[model samples]
Target: MDSKIKISITNFITVIYLFCFLIISNGTYISTAAKIFFSILVFFSMIINYKKVFNAFSLWLVIYTLFVLSSVSWALYGEFARQSASTVVYTTICSLAIPLLLINNKKDLEFFYKIIIVLPLIYYIYYLIFYDVPNIFDLRQDASNQIYNNIGLYAAYSFLFVMIYQAEREKRNIYYDVFFVIDLFLIIISQSRKSFIYIGIIVILSMILESKNVLKTLLRILLVFVLLFIAYQVVKNGLFGDSMKELLLSFEGDASDSSYVGRMNQFDISIGLFNQNRFLGLGIGAIEYVCRFVHGQSAPIVDNDYLDILSDLGIIGMVIYYGFHIYLLIQYIYNKKKWNKKNLLFFVLLIMLFIQGFLIRGYFNNYYIPILLYLIYYDTKTLKQDDSTILET
Candidate 1:
């Protein structure tokens, strides 16, 4: 195939699967068909790039999925376990692997990352066109007129992506300005508290990583809190409305409030369940078991991804599940030897996926695939060819 045609074909197939993922959970005809179809496309990509098939990173992906699948033997809900296995397979092969093989250079990385960053804005556009925008605008509906936190969470970090892009470039340009604004607008309209805090963390991390002066970074951190105070005092009511304001203040309430305690009781239950099967785990989506057998709820539906992964997958699963991320982190650090943008970028992503509520429960998908793709893409494209620079202008 001609180089130009090959690039176009690769990108086209990738876009199809990417869109498939955005709707893969709908349980609709299109959703089911798209997943199966795009999964086949993923296979085709793998077959065509068979030399990269056994790449160490790619093998780890398969191993990770197999472990998730293995949990079905002990899964509390076999169907959910199958679904979890299916998700890992789909995400691994389609989202992570295909993109990994396709992105062979800095140009590919920039284009792919740009699309990932813009996806949230595109989804927002779709929601505005299709959903009840008035209710969402007034905070009557879920933020972004969608039940999931996908838009806000992804959008918040898209700003950080802009910084990553900046790292790739010699200088900032108008694309940075436009994307920063679009990312901020999407995050704000979604009113996701996690997203809000994610942005704050990104800002602080950027200051700390990019600057050498300790005093300047500390002052920037302090200035962040000052600006935060102003936003709390004035911006919430005007921009996000009363509902969001109430949510913002929800944290300041008594920690022992019944609502808060009720929410955390599940976590307590999760810990107990983990102890029971600490080594092998209860299976993926084990929290649903926690919710059902223990709490009588319909689903696991917890916000904490770490607990969700730990309780369901257990110690062995934890090592495999997190092992891939650790692998990527080590690869990037080895390839890029500085306290670079990619280091802090990956750190923020790990924290979000680890400790925070970047949940699978209310998301189209987790950001894991994108992060994996990024880490691998950087390593493969720029691996220790001395004096090599970052992304193309």
Candidate 2:
């Protein structure tokens, strides 16, 4: 195969998926359409590029596939499970498509970074000028709380994109550093506790990684204080508006007012459900009915991804869910002495995924999980060989 053709096809597919993820941030119709197209792209890419098959079939990915199948098989209502299972299908396709289609070289990874950062900057601009303000502009009717969620997730994506890119390039470009700061700002403005926690963990772990000396450790401690003080001022100043405050504070409210407590109750039920089906799980989408019944009225969906998987997929599903994390930790340890820079980058990503999963019910989202997985896969692929630095450019 000609290198030019391969690069072109890879770049085109990469752009398409990045565009799809951005549009997904805006609404559901585009997201659904993008998922379908992306699936076709993955299948075609797989068939045409059979040599790349191994990239798609990591132990982690297989475990995830098994969990998906088990979820569908054990589903209390196959119809509802089928709908939820679409996420599983789309996720599998995207995960395979990533290492197959993207990260051919360091250059490709670098291009990926540019796209992730630039596109969301455009989206954030639109959000601020349009969605953030009322009467001045109106967003699509479907762009509601869900859109805000997409905003937070994409913002986190941008942060990780910058982190990995900066680490690999081994230079602190002012533009990317500024973008990281802005990413944190956007996260805070979004008033998403999950987002805050996502970056917070990254900062903490990065400090730990970089803190070889006592002075560096102290500086990191000071940095944390500064960040916390700034956050307190931001919240106290009411920068994110009443709705954001209410959402954040909902975590501490009483049983009557606590949406957070509802998720806790659901978590307890999920544990009970997991006990009943320790291995196979109740199957995906089984717990929505359970949640509905428990709440009496329709329970607003929970965001604790781990609990959701626990109740629906059980312990086996949890293993599948965490397979990538396990693989990543092992990979990091193996490469620890060779590349401190890449190790730190992987550490940031691992912490972000762990924190975000716990803080939000994000494990089953059709968009972000695959993106995170692909990012890790590509990072591993690139870091495995120093010569493949095309993406770093």
Candidate 3:
């Protein structure tokens, strides 16, 4: 293939991968068609690069894939097991195969980041036009609405990448600052409370990472809090004050709240399920059946990723699942000499994703695994280049 053709094909694949994140299944033919298209693109890409594909596969990925595939034997629900296995395979291809094969240079990486950021900006505009903008003071807005609120989270995640990229290049400017504020606004309006908190923490960490002057950074943070306080007061007494009161009251409500109580019950059920099947647990797709039949609940998956893994995969499974991530963190730390603003941002993002996993099912989230793989590829590529340089010397 011509070099130009290869670049075009790789870029096309990158766009398709990003598009997969934007897909929202609405139980329509169009949604189904979109998913099919994405799968075909991924499958085609894998076939084209079959020889080099395994180069991207790490020991952890291999083990996790085997574990998921093996779950079929012990899975309580045959269909769910098959579906779960398929999902794992698909996600693996998207997160590892496509990027590893296509993204050969920094330009490719930047292009991926650009698409991820722009897509979320488009989503933010869509939300502003279609959805009722939640007043800042109004707390009554549903923060847990994953469907629409997730767009904001996605946007925030992408925005963080863009900022990190800029910081890495020493190119931070007004545009990034503007987008940062816009991203924060969108996150607040989306009412994804956990995401809101995560984004805030990421923003603070990014500021600290990028700042050369510690005292100035501290002053800037203090100013930020002061401004936030002023904004809070203004919104508190504004037209949305009543709605904000309702929201605050909801938070103040204790564990008796249905959502809280339900989650607690789920934790108990997951623990019980793990105890029952100590070795392998219920298998990949057994959560739904276990929840419905054993616990008399409608939810198939729990909100907590750790608990879900424990219930479905068991103690050994948990070790494999979390152990892989812990290993990655260790690797990043070991390579501290290679650390830059960009790598620091990746580390912080990984930490944020790990924290989010405790509150929500974020372990294998679309962005999380891909980011990890990208970092691994980067490290490997850099090491090879260094070795080549040493040989030349």
Candidate 4:
């Protein structure tokens, strides 16, 4: 294939993948079909790149996905379970396959970075014009509810890659600067507390890893916190009015927060259910079926990712899932000398992902996990060359 053609093809498929992940979800028939189609293409691509992309991490993911699918056999709500299981499988493939097989060079990676940041804003515009969502621009109370939580998290994820992209290059670009501001605004309006906290921690850690001067880094960190403090006071004072305060104050981890309550409620329900199925789980989708179909709540019922894995996949399943994580950690520590900003940040992401998993679900479908997995098997010798060349290209 011609170089441009290959790039275009990959870009097309990737945009479809991102569209499914960020804009629409499996809940809708059209999006469900799109996800399935994207997953099929990813599956074929993974097979084609089997020699290069296939590894223990990828294999572990395949196994975990298969295990989830297998649970459909014993699921109480078998049809719903299969549909739910298929969604997980499809998303897992879409997320993992991108980093593993599609992202082949600096250009592809950069293209992906742009897609992650831009697509959701496009969707938000579409939604704004069409839907009855609150005026997020007006910054009214409950503005964040204008979009689904996961949809808003798309902005958070986009900002994540933006930071990573900037971290990779020594010379910062105004290109990323624009998106940096946009992403922060989107995150703020999303009212996702975990998104704010997660990005803060990750950004600081990446700066620490990539920093050459401790004093400079410390000053920068202090500056960040100072700005945050100012922002806090502004919101607390209702400088924009009580409604604006309500909109932004969702940043705090109030015990009575609905998202927190959803997590705890799901955790409690998961524990109660897990006690019954101590080994293999009640079968994939069983929990979602009970919660959404039976009880009419948000599907998956378990809002916590770790608990989601434990509750749906069970003890045996968690082992298969975390085993890949453990392998990556061991490799990162064992090859400390080879560590650089990219891989080191990936390691940090993995750890923070675990922490984030406690608060949010869907780590299985996060594109970053497979990228981290790819880094684990990535050649150390090439890391130096790739690091330099990425900037040049």
Candidate that scores best on lDDT: 2
Score every model by TM-score.
Answer: 0.82, 0.81, 0.76, 0.77
Provide backbone clash counts, one per model: 0, 12, 3, 0
Q: Write the per-residue lDDT of candidate 4 for residues 1-393, one digit (tens) a residue.
A: 113434487788777666665566447886778767766777677677666446575677778888888888876577877877776677677666665556777677767666766765776676677566765664334553435344446666666666666766778776666776776676665555566667766766666556557797787788778867886797679663454355455546445445445655666777776777778877776666667766676645575766766667788888888787777667666665566555666666766766766765554455545554554444333444443333110
What TM-score would you give candidate 3 relative to the actual structure? Answer: 0.76
lDDT against true structure, model 4: 0.64
TM-score of predicted structure 1: 0.82
Q: What lDDT is reached at residue 63 by model 1?
A: 81
lDDT score at residue 376, model 2, on the 0-100 scale: 71
Q: Which stretches of candidate 3 lie over 4 Å from their true place?
A: 1-9, 26-48, 56-59, 100-102, 126-145, 207-253, 292-299, 363-393
Arrange candidates by lDDT, descending: 2, 4, 1, 3
Model 1, which residues run further than 4 Å from truth?
A: 1-7, 23-25, 139-145, 228-240, 255-262, 292-294, 331-351, 355-383, 386-393
Count of clashing pairs, candidate 4: 0
Give the higher-TM-score candidate: 1 or 2.
1
Error at 344, model 2, angstroms: 0.5
lDDT score for candidate 3 against the true structure: 0.62
Q: lDDT by residue for model 1 over 313-362, one digit each (tens)?
A: 88887787667667666765565444345555665555555445444442
Q: How many Å off is the CA of 221 in candidate 1?
A: 3.4
Which candidate should be chosen as best, given TM-score against the real structure? 1
